[model samples]
Target: MAAFTDATRVRSDGEGGFEADLDPLWTVGGKPNGGYLLAILARAAVEAAGTQPHPMSASAVYLSPPDPGPAAVTVEVLRAGRSASQVRARLSQKDRTCVEALFTLGTLAAAGDPRWIDSTPPPVAAEADLLPTPSEAPGTGLRIDMLDQFEQRIDWQAVGDPAGELRGWLRLPDGVGWDPVSLLFAADAFPPATFTLGSNGWTPTLELTVYVRALPAPGPLRVRQRARLLTESLVDQVCEIWDADGHVVAQATQLAAYRMAG
Candidate 1:
């Protein structure tokens, strides 16, 4: 697994907010990626909770285009309960707020009743292989931005391959002692389903959400994703993160607006 590193600079303002300058190379399509900001806000929430079991659910809203330059993340602990905790964070670049989020921490109880529901898992290939290290792969320009966090396998390299819908496995570098939320971090950036819309064009994400049932262990984390174009700007993609054992641990969905670009 490759290393995921960012040159993020952080300092606390006298006022309960923090300012940080995260590296620009990690941005998506030359815009600051959501995972970059989510990680920072979550780190603050995690520290605020001080050993809380784990976060139950977290959501973020994208309000403006995130600048690839330095930005700020402001966090506030809303409430800490004996059984749950809440926190809010907002990400800003210069004077504009780009992302906002709310995080929840709590414990879970065993299901009073046990029942099984229909669910599907990612498909396996008879001999599926990992794609080349981003630096060694073909193509250039915007696609290069994907190199920072994912390693994909083009199952067939179709005409609409990376366009609206796509299928492939991904890995989050083994560094960072293996963060449990790394899967959530991975899920934060879901591909646009209508990749085919731009199979000959370009599309930008409107927003993204991830639900982490679990995360990869401290090593190479595998992720499989597929995107489907729902409309011109309303595209959706779903992905599942799995462990080496072939268990689905985290799932994600994304919304994006499509456009034909140079």
Candidate 2:
């Protein structure tokens, strides 16, 4: 497996075009994870901006799942401002578009503290009480290769509950600390919140939006994800990631299409 930085790296082709080889280890059920693809696009967008270094917000729509191999990225700078830059990016393979995203890039600094706070990272069992997130879905042979790239502990007890919520901890492997770009991956690294409702089928993300609030402190990250609503074939999930120091670092929401396993 490649390092997260190396796996998401993109090289400039000198004309708003970037070349990247999507790593296979970032795939879930043979398709590249939506967040991983977003990270790749964010990296390219940052590089294209040439001034802004962080992706503050990214809204993406997944069109098709591309294979784990070479892909092309094209970025168009929409507006470059003194404090922020906006860009539109697309990832394509075999002449077909896979993911399209719009990103706002800027340098993020800690804003002292929140004046009014409401959302907090949900409490979970102690590390000793949680179970290691399985590499494969329970009772299914489908491989979640993405788990190999990080450390995640899941509260199985909560997974069995009727509530559509999951609490866990995650950290990058190989001592690679978390950065703004990496936080994009962290937002979607956990198992889908719908799993708590006993639906383990593949949930392909139709759209995902992530906001990077601040840089994470050194240590493992605590994560909480919940499904807000699940219709007959579509579900919406929200995820919040807090750094070890309990500061909210990132938040994300996604809508996905799913079907119950027989």
Candidate 3:
């Protein structure tokens, strides 16, 4: 199996656009994962800017579910500054746009001293000590093929009674390196935290925002997800990604519509 990096690699289309093969191994419940698609678009946006800035922030709206196959990414640079560049990217399949994203690219500080902060890392056990989610678990429509690509250990204590909160340890299979791009995938990789609240169908994301704080170290990442608010049919999920070194690497918030099984 190819690593996630190679599977999501985008190549120049020779016409100022980028193209990539959307592999099914990254799909969930037979649809391409939004974060995976966002990573693809972010790659195209960074490539279009020609500045090689790391992904600082990305806001994406998923218009439709794209099939696992070839897709085109068109990028338009909104602004490029000395320290950051803003760009928009569109992902199209068969000439129908499926995903649109705005990205801010900039160099992350190699080392920094914080002035003030209030957030704290979530409590996560060692990967080996945590329980692995069963591949055939009920109500979890996760594809085994996709699960094979990642190592996930659930923190069942935090997930008590499906109150829309979950914490876990997640990482790619060996040989896949960690980067800001991969962090996008990690942000949305878990099953919807709302599922714990008895929501039993696909929760499709409408809009997702991810902020990259720092480069991750080599090891499993601690992911904490919780539902901030759930209205009639809409859910707001926030996720925090902490690297092995205990520093927060990325944070994500997504708005999705909840569906119930018939």
Candidate 4:
């Protein structure tokens, strides 16, 4: 099994460029997971920022789903601020643009709590009280092999009788811990909320935006994914990840193209 760090590693190829191998393990329905792809771009963006090591905000448009292979990332520094830096990154495979992203890189104050907050983590059951989802979705045709990288405990009852929301718990393997970049992956790590609505098959993300709020405390994350709206051929999904300390570590919203399974 490839660790999250190893799977998402990007090496410097040249000035403003990086090289990475898109691991096959991080795919959904044989295509790279959108969040995983965003994490890859985040890694490169942070490194290119020189001093800014965290991706504060990232907005990506998925042009194409690249296969698992060597991919190139080229980053352009848009501006360097006193506290944050902005950069644009592109991931391409076979000379075709696959993902284009704009990232705001900065550092988070890891010690302080939010001054005033209106949102809180969902009331998910304790990890011990939830049922584990299988790592492989064999018959579903979704091919969520990406689940192999993390430990997940899902609320099956809520899934069976969803109330406009899907809840779960997620954590990295024994060795890896959640960081800002990994939190990007966590934001898109859950089963689509559409699953609770009797929708199936691949929900290919058209656009995804993630905000990394804070560094996670050490433990399994509390996750809640909900559907905001759905059209005949598209769906809007929002996901939130709270750390063990009950801090909102990351949040993401995506628009995807989907078809209801017959």
Candidate 5:
């Protein structure tokens, strides 16, 4: 099995460009996961800039779904300053744009003193204590296969309930350590929190922005996601990813369009 880093690896294509093979193991349903695609673009941007700045924030807009094959990532440096670099990256397949993103890169201090804060990590059960989802039969579809890429222990008590909240333990398959880049994928790995409110059908993300706060410790990540507001056709989700040591590693907010069953 290819490690997550190797699966999402991007190679230099030439000046100001890079190329990657989108592995099928990262696809959900029939489309590649949005966060996985964003990580590819972010990696390209960081390399093109040559600043070695860690990914601080990224805002991505998913235009279309790219096939699980070779894709081209072209990056343009908007500004490279002493503190940060801003770049625009676009992933195109067969000359058609699939995803576009603006990335902000900056160095993160390993240690810093915070003045005040009110956020706290949510309580969740240990990974071994949670129940595993039932195994799917052969040819069950690519979604199940994609989920298998990560170890997820969901809080079933919150699922299908009317709390508009979801909590769980999530981590990459064993051998893949946590990194800032991978947090991009982790931010969007959970099922839509809107499902708890009796909403069903595909909820496609229109836009997603993730903020990386700190490096993660080596263990399963604690994932907390909830919906703050919902309209007839839209939902706003907020998520926080806490490292094993109970520190916030990343946070994300996304706006998605809710599609009802026909």
Candidate 6:
């Protein structure tokens, strides 16, 4: 029922770059949150591409822990075409890169193909029905409260049992728009184990990536996650995201460097 008070504010830093002030509301484990950085990265891409008749797809990488102050964003116009544009957005602190995003904007005029296809959505417990979510338990792994900000739900089995896979649904903040940009937001919260592993003490995102297939229509969002210990010290999370009708929406793969306990 509450809204995020510290929404990001974008401004020009001259030389064609932008900056977003980091506030307390966008935090994970009491530190700056990944969603905040991702949101700013996507916003930079949209601004650099200018306004389009249609939405866009964006992918980002988290390079380092962001400071608790203002974040400098650099946007580059990689390419421009009649129907699409490519732009790169980088978030930096102290002249070093903290995060980066690559995005594509599509031009549409609302006067083209009008065909439609119906598909089945992933099966989930009814909204009125009950569903399981992650909880805080002693050591073993991390616990998440997805219900706090997003509507998506992750069962305790995914983490408490540490099975090889993760399964759940993702939803937008109660009143957000249902566009490709919304898809970008839905896909942004995953590869959660980066913090899970770090939770043993503290670890920050080293890098994050998300791929887009097809944006889901407005409704409940679903996510299925599975991870493999690629090396003795590295973990790769392979993810599948679906819409409420069980239709596959997107897939993502991310690698996280484990942090030692503090």
What's the lDDT for all of these models? 0.57, 0.87, 0.84, 0.86, 0.82, 0.59
Q: Best to worst by lDDT, what's the order? A: 2, 4, 3, 5, 6, 1
Deviation from native of the Cα of residue 59 in model 5, angstroms: 0.2
Best by lDDT: 2
Score candidate 5 by lDDT.
0.82
Model 2: lDDT equals 0.87
Answer with 1 or 3, whichever has the higher TM-score: 3
lDDT of 5 by residue, 37-67 (tens): 9889888989889885678999998888898
What TM-score does candidate 5 get on C-alpha atoms? 0.91
Residue-level lDDT for 14 in candidate 3: 99
Q: What tens digits encode model 6's per-residue C-alpha lDDT throughout 1-262?
A: 2243235556887768888886655455545566567667766677776854334556667777776688798988788777778888888888888888777777533222225535443344455353534334356354444335656566544542355554566655665533444455555464455444432443354555655555565676677666566365666776666765555665566666565456
Per-residue alpha-carbon lDDT of model 2 for 69-167, expressed as tens digits?
A: 999999999999899999999999999999999999999986336676787657877766776676785676789888877888987776645488888
* List of clashing residue pairs for candidate 2: none
Clashing pairs in 6: 120-245, 120-246, 121-244, 121-245, 121-246, 122-246, 166-225, 170-221
TM-score of each: 0.76, 0.95, 0.93, 0.94, 0.91, 0.73
- lDDT by residue (149-192, candidate 4, tens digit) is 67878877666345658888997877467899888888888888
Question: Please, what's the RMSD in Å of model 3?
Answer: 2.0
Model 2 regions lying over 4 Å from their true place: 160-162
Model 1 lDDT tens row, 1-262: 3334343344676576777776566666666667666666666566656546555566777788776666777888888888778888788877888888788766533212225525544454322454433532345345546456555444445424445444455554444533444455666544443544544334555666666554344444345566654654465667666655455556667666665435
Error of 3 at 198 (Å): 1.6
Task: Flag the better candidate by TM-score, 2 or 5.
Answer: 2
Worst 10 contiguous positions by lDDT, candidate 6: 108-117
Q: Cα-based RMSD of the predictions, in order?
A: 4.4, 1.8, 2.0, 1.8, 2.6, 5.0
